[model samples]
Target chain A: MTLRAASTAAADRARIRAGEHTGPTSGLAPGLAQANLVILPADESLDFPRFCVRNPKPCPLLEVTDTGSAHPDCVAADADLRTDLPRYRVFRDGRLVDEPTDIAQFWRSDLVAFLLGCSFTFEWALAAAGLPIAHQAQGVNVPMYVTNRRCISAGRFDGPLVVSMRPFAPDVISHVVDISARFPAMHGAPVHIGDPEEIGIDDLAAPDFGDAVVVGADEVPVFWACGVTPQAVAIQARPSLAIFHAPGHMFITDRHHDDFDTGESHDHP
Target chain B: MTLRAASTAAADRARIRAGEHTGPTSGLAPGLAQANLVILPADESLDFPRFCVRNPKPCPLLEVTDTGSAHPDCVAADADLRTDLPRYRVFRDGRLVDEPTDIAQFWRSDLVAFLLGCSFTFEWALAAAGLPIAHQAQGVNVPMYVTNRRCISAGRFDGPLVVSMRPFAPDVISHVVDISARFPAMHGAPVHIGDPEEIGIDDLAAPDFGDAVVVGADEVPVFWACGVTPQAVAIQARPSLAIFHAPGHMFITDRHHDDFDTGESHDHP
Candidate 1:
């Protein structure tokens, strides 16, 4: 495989593929997109992509690799899925089995890889738009909660929708909505704003996953569809074999953030 | 299944479902969205949805019905796909076999339906925005041509891209671009703006499908991906049984034009 576009993303993927970098990909490839990876057997994974389409907010699809092909030609020209991500999590019948730096040994001819839009794209857009992210400012992982809204199921992949919270003062919430709405592939706008109980969230300090943050005076908590959905669904559906990127360790692609604007020409996954 | 929302679109669907309306659905539901319909069996049509996701420009998906279900609960809650469309064209082994008003006779136990975003949404937006459409003013079908662009192939569906032309004067082309870009699900933005032959179109007056209108002096031709792509591919791929909405006779849904704006909440299918 060869990369037609040169960017820091290609360099990062090369390092991860070589087993030289085995850490989180959060800080790498500053302007490019980092995808949430889910690789499943071709024979059993038909409904997963369908699930993504039905629930686009929580599971925005970026690129789906051809069956048995490790290369996702549309998103990254030279990238290889088998060893591209910094870290990997192997799920066997919905149980976590191993965390490997590379999955060349686990690669199968019947595997199909799915790359989903990550919040990092929206966070990048927010930061660029001068919107302050609460979790980032507090130096804590964004808080995630499992909401009561059940996803419209497709086959066996079904679960409660998970959301990541970011608090913004009431003054700037409108701008946040407008800016985030500009990137639908990146979870788009908040699924719920204001009351947590409206969507079945009971606590602000205690979250289902990640760290809690301080909600300042008169600040409204905003929740967006989280990229952790596929992982949650995999644990429930219990697929025979599923491979995913470990938390915060993503597949950096040659595609830039702007390419996911929902304009037909750009988001071609 | 019941409709949660009611509009003129629902009334129009009721008329068509009763077999009282056997004409094109263009002017039926003025403000609501109309969809291009394609139905295939569940067992053999796995790759068709994948093809739509990959080639979203021409095939932006609105709602994909559950396996063996004719009710598109998302787009039209109570409408039945087997009878709601004004007309249906049945293709057998890649050749047009019948054009029936209703496909209840052809419906099978494992059939799956796909509803795609049509140019009607964008045209509705354009008209609402007060932009003049060339073909509509001339009272002709929008001219369409087979382009050299090859859509990303999936399983048994593969074919060349088809685009519909809309001529706009130089001064208003930018506004037209901005307006159409808002509705990505509706074949968003012109795939080719300036030259016809540049994208493989030879003559402006001669189109592969649909009627051509006269292009005024100084008005440049803009071409957007047409919804006929899936039909063309079905013809080439030759699925054992494929059904589509007869040209100009679409499935009017309860979804409004603004609902398709890339805003996460509005367009949920």
Candidate 2:
């Protein structure tokens, strides 16, 4: 299947829903919002909401669907929840059972879908300022870690705060923080910078989550809240049923990614 | 009971936890964070989390406690969730049943506690910037409303978005937006400014939630997402068990109200 550029998020979602685009959605719709998807049984819904609320740094919420409502009406009008994402993960009793492009076969009315803000939003801010994201340049996954600090738990959702690490020169760290901070809809700002041990990550090369990236000697390791949190915490809680986007396969939204920039309005004013 | 102004939120929480203070906790600990509390059974936890993630404007999550765990490690640092708040409301099957000072007697092992961001944090920001908050001057409850617009539902947690209204002169609305935008931890910025009907609110005099205040002709009716959202949505969902802060009563946290400001760091550099 051929991937198209400048496709509106809605158009891209339709193509993905139709199984025409099985590739990663990076740069597909430059301005559209892309989301991290987490689906869980209704029983754990309340605690999850509390968890996201307490940990907004990593899981800045975009849209939460009605119980069993696969459509995220607020962000993507009339979009199908089960199949719009390029790929998905099925976790049963804390273990991965399947990696499929569509979750329609396992759809449940009792399942709740949470569309969380992803770092893709902030990448727009960085690019707007002409800063290059290293991972994107290398065509590899961004590094992530399970921090020593525990996240505020809610009911069946409790675990350590997870952070995504990005290496940048000292001059760029402040710029990165400023750029990312403007996109609070995405994980906003760095949780830790310069020191890895302070947050209990001893080896930058070995991450608990995503693949690690090389940090230049002059570059400082800057960390932001990671979307992997809900998955990590939820799995630890061992819900009977859970579904999420497969790593690197996100749900693309109708919103232009630029709309995710909270600071754009400031600039206009 | 005597009112005390303690220097630390922990100290204030200790006093409240010991049954020494039973009144509103509006201005007790100047720097400590105060939250809107919502409690529900484990069964509804999943849906509620989705609800909060979807309707972030009305439900800025602060902390979510584990099942049967009254203590949220992030917000209060050992404070009991069931009793730290000045008061609570018990809703059974959607109907409010009781308003009590402490919920320890009613605590269940399956219950989950959620602490949501309150407007108090943003109000502190406005006051710090010399913006006038009329309700603070009148010593009354902030005006809130149930709008015609529906919130994104998660399971049973579906209802109209409830917003707290504040009137600001046209000149100050932009500053209010800018200042409040910095505190995304506290509902961030105004969801709607100027026209209420655009969001489905018809009359300003009639509020679906809190008391109505005067809005002068020279002022624009600015609305921020209210913490009342969880309660209103939960009631609509009609969970078998639900508890929340009784309107104005709130949970005092160790973090101060001003600590929510995400702008100072950005402004300093």
Q: Largest DockQ belongs to which candidate?
A: 1
* Tens-place lDDT digits, model 1, residues B136-227: 99988999999999999987899999999998888777778867887777888778788888889989899999998899888889889999
RMSD of 1: 3.3
Per-model TM-score versus the true fold:
0.94, 0.85
Residue-pair clash count for candidate 2? 26
Q: Go through the candidates in order and give each one's DockQ.
A: 0.36, 0.32
- What is candidate 2's lDDT per residue for B42-101, written digit by digit as tens? 766656765676677788777777778888777666678877778889999899899988
Q: What is the lDDT of residue B56 in candidate 2?
A: 71
For residues A1-269, write the lDDT of model 1, one tens digit per residue: 12433457787788888788998887788878888999999888978877887788898777777789998887787789988898899999999999998899999999999888899988988898899988888888889999999987888999999999998887788778766876777888788888999989999899999999999888889999999987799678898999999988998988778766653332210
Candidate 2 lands at a TM-score of: 0.85
- Top model number, lDDT: 1
Error of 1 at B99 (Å): 0.6
Model 1 TM-score relative to the real fold? 0.94
